[model samples]
Target chain A: MCGQNMLDIEGLVLRRGRRLLARRIDLRVDRGAFAYIVGPNGSGKSTLLRVLAGFGRPEEGVIRWSGRTIGEWGGAYRGEVAFLGHLEGIKPMLTPEENLAYRRLLVGPTGWRVPTPSPFFDASALPDLPCQRLSAGQRRRVSLACLEHSAAPLWLLDEPLTSLDHDGVAALGGLLARHLMAGGTAVVASHQPLPPTLVPATVLELGTKR
Target chain B: MNGLLGAQLRMIYRARGDYLAPVIFYVLVASLFPLALGPSPRLLSLIAPGVIWIDATLASVVAFAGLFRDDYDDGSLEQMLLSPRPLELIVLVRVFAGWVSLSLPLVLLAPLLALWFSFPPPILPVLLVSLVLTTGCLTLLGALGSALTVGLRHSLVLLPVLLLPLATPVLIFGAHAVLLAERGLDPRTPLYVLAALFFLALALIPKATAAALRVALEV
Candidate 1:
């Protein structure tokens, strides 16, 4: 039970150019916990998630994973994070399976069995076509499939619901529930409401207090 | 590592046009020199090493300038950054793939260009070896330039200005090696120096590229 809050940020400041977006912020999310970052446009929701995922530097403060600063954790920290930004990260020339396969391989061996073919996108329906041929929603689903195979304990999803259909949302809800049950943590930044099942989650609103 | 390499190779395979464009450009540029310089065999052979080297350098610069641009735009580079694998390792694999796809063809075609330039048969091997070293160095340097400018608009316009200056040492040594070999003198010293530069770039550029990419992502 020691170091229960596996993800911790202390006295954080985030700025976009000279304008301050978030300041003197503190956040902690334990394993299996869920946190929602909700705010209007340009509120730093995406920026916050990007910082949490170790992409950008916070203007001030430290982000600690499992009691170690992310820089100290280095590649070890990256091993535990699966970040999905607005771009989807899908190589359009590659099929969904190819994208997911390479995604899994890039993270190195997690000792987790290769996940049974992703339930997010049906192979029969979509076929083995290049992601370029897939619809935007289909591509989004393909990116979601990467999460299913990632085996990373922490997921920092920035607007993951973008372009997802109702069924896709339901599917994502199911995936989130299963992941939480399996002792995973998720920090999501979104404008849309998450499924009912994901309630009892901490909501961190940006741009309002300041 | 093999998986990353394989994936990159597959990308090169699928995007054949982008890789082939540089090779075709090298061929056209090299062929143009023979036509422009007239049929003087001595003059043709005299300029062969320098012309071939400059063409190869330009071709590689063009091909590799956008190396990280597409990946950066598509967000795949960010995923690569998130991987537990060292960023330097990923950068190395990517540059190696770019070399194999874009530069290797130029090397394979060097013999034909040598024959056209009427290069001495004995110096042909030297030409090939120097090109291999020079191209590898240029690709590594281009990868670094690509990483630095990936975040900016009009990065392609800025790429050559940043890369060509850094590539001069490689060009000088590589061309000088072939020129020496053509004159029946020992080309080993310049070749050795080219090899040292290649090895040194091989050791350092990937790390620098990785750091540049990390900073690029911060913006």
Candidate 2:
């Protein structure tokens, strides 16, 4: 995926109500690179992530993917990016396996069905249970499973490590390394350090410009 | 299209327990009015229209809470918002799912409730017709309410306040239709009005709900 920059943000500004969260920010995440976005609380890290993922439009500036403005990228084109916000985004009523299967159908290639034995087939073996009954770390793992299986070429994660244990964090780091190694790109927003193994990542500190 | 619809249906059915609870509440509420009014057939008949209409209206409001709360709590709403599918289409599926899980049962059980109130036999068809149309309108209205209160706590109070006023037309038409039917007069006028209201809601509410959800999510 490194032939071109998969994500480009220039002169981006985001505001919440009367407060200016971020201003005049420029960021770029190329194909196959892991980029980290860090800032203190209310630093607009989530805002920037939302804009980059095409969920929230920037107050001012342009976000482009592969040379086309994000707004210009139609549904099919934008589908190439997977976003995980602070919210776990997994339905509590659904089991871990069902959540993954549902998301697989949503963002997977059109006409794609969950494979007979899903990659996360192991999730089904644990128990027939609702996600709310699962531990926070377990829910996070289920969400990560969905992200891993998504065919999207770019990933935008907000606080992806919020509820993970040491092993879970390491597993996520492994997933990120594998994704990058496979030529996929990612922009992660977090206050925590990523696993040491995934190196040479570019870091952008929001609000540092002021 | 298939994915959005299928996901919505699955999510709604998974909350089957919550959905069924409101229908049971509706039956209980409808039954209490007759007993409280002392079982006088005249008194029961006199208030039956209002009783059924109130019961159905309250049931829809109660079920509306489950429409977006589960999805919001589970993070499913955020996931859907970011999906390749148009937000409008996704919101439509949600509204459809809410109707299927919450409102559909109420319509189906209207006959039984009507019997309990000893509604005139001739009025039964009109009651069912009014319910079918009103349920469609209520579902759309409820979707709008759900979108407004997406991430807020105490949404239970906010939902009814926002929805009940908007639902007045449905309640009015529904009760009137039942009254006309009981009089053995043609209830066609109110029934047609309710159908038109449902169509108007169907044409317009999904887009409104979608826009509301987008704004709510951005905040």
Candidate 3:
């Protein structure tokens, strides 16, 4: 793992089609920092998270992770990131257990730092069943399970709160708290306000895009 | 690296049922030509090279829908896009796995299919060689097409349109080589062209497909 835990975004200008989504934005997040990028519908929350995740290039900006430019880091940076986009990324034909089984491979060698699913994980009804048989909330849980044992220090979650039940929401908050306590960083893009029980995080809410 | 490849192989293995449809489609298509043209063995032998080549190409297109569709729909594509594994290598492995599971059967089954066409037995080896090499080239091109269109709605139509112009050369050289082998003439020229295409695809298409996949996944 790199010795640094900082994400520095300077003068970020994001666009979609001909419209300006979010522009001239700057933010800095240090190790163990939890950040929420809140925005209304069509406000570029997903686009911004995607840009930071290296899925989409911003029109203008520099994003630095652990002191290296994400571009220069290139494929190496992917190993350091656990990105969960709007989709659960689940294979409907495979069981939940089968899906997350590939996580270690995708992230490369995690050695012994793979986080085990704990009592707080609420993995009660997740395994064994083909993912197609699961409900939306159940599918969300299975997808989040990928992050439960993630070795990557950076988590880029897009709309993680969608379709989650109260219990599922609390489980996610607990996981986030644990990740923060362990010195990892998370960038959660959601329109929903976080539950009351979670730890405080730096909030970067984007105004509505007309 | 082993883990990544293992997981990819596992996914392919688990989806063994999916590989059947295209091969079956290939046979069904080949069967139609014999029925349409009547039972004349002489005529069947005459058109055999073109008939088999067309079906093989179409059968690969049948396999194309599955190439990236499952991953894109269920979100595994996102995981793959962001995985620490090099996108180019991931694409290469995907194409390789696809060829092994999906196209290898078509290659193995070609001799039997060739019998239906009354293709001269002497040319079977040459047919297999052409199938194996052409299959690799098609899979590479098909993958690049799949990656480019994965994020689009109604890309099934778009895929073939994008692929056909590029695929015309593969068809020309592949079928021509098989015909030359049939006639007992030296098929070296087209065989060399197919080899060149395979190596070029091996070196270049993965990077292009990877870049296309990145664009497809972008919002």
TM-scores of the candidates in the order shown: 0.95, 0.91, 0.93
Model 2 chain A weakest 10-residue run by lDDT: A112-121
**Residue range B1-219, candidate 2, lDDT tens digits:** 677677778876776776789989999998888777787887787888888888888888888865776667767777777677677777787788778778888988888877777777777778888888988898888888888887788998888998999999999998898888788888989888999999999888888887877776774
List, residue by residue over B98-144, the lDDT tens digit for candidate 3: 88888998999988888998889988888889888888999999898
For the predicted complex of model 3, DockQ is 0.66
Please report the interface RMSD of model 3 to 1 decimal. 1.8
Residue A184 Cα positional deviation in candidate 1, in Å, after optimal superposition: 1.0
| DockQ ranking of the models | 1, 3, 2
Q: What does the i-RMS of model 2 come to?
A: 2.2
How close to the true structure is residue B110 of candidate 3, measured as C-alpha lDDT? 89
Pairs with backbone N, CA or C atoms under 3 Å apart (clashes), candidate 1: none
Best by lDDT: 1
Q: Supply candidate 3's per-residue lDDT for A145.
A: 81
Worst 10 residues of 1 chain A by lDDT: A111-120
- Per-residue lDDT of candidate 1, residues A87-158 (tens digit): 989888888878877787787777233444456545335658888888999988888887777788888999
Model 3 / residue B60 / CA error / Å: 1.0
Q: What's model 2's lDDT at A161?
A: 90
What DockQ do the predictions score, one after another?
Answer: 0.75, 0.54, 0.66
Model 2 lDDT per residue over A1-210, tens place: 213547777898888777998878777778788788889998888888777776667779987888888777766555777888888888888888888777865664652334223342146644568888988878888888778777677888999898888877887888777778767889998888888887736788887666
Chain A TM-scores of all predicted models: 0.91, 0.89, 0.90
Name the runs in model 1 displaced over 4 angstroms: A111-118, A121-125
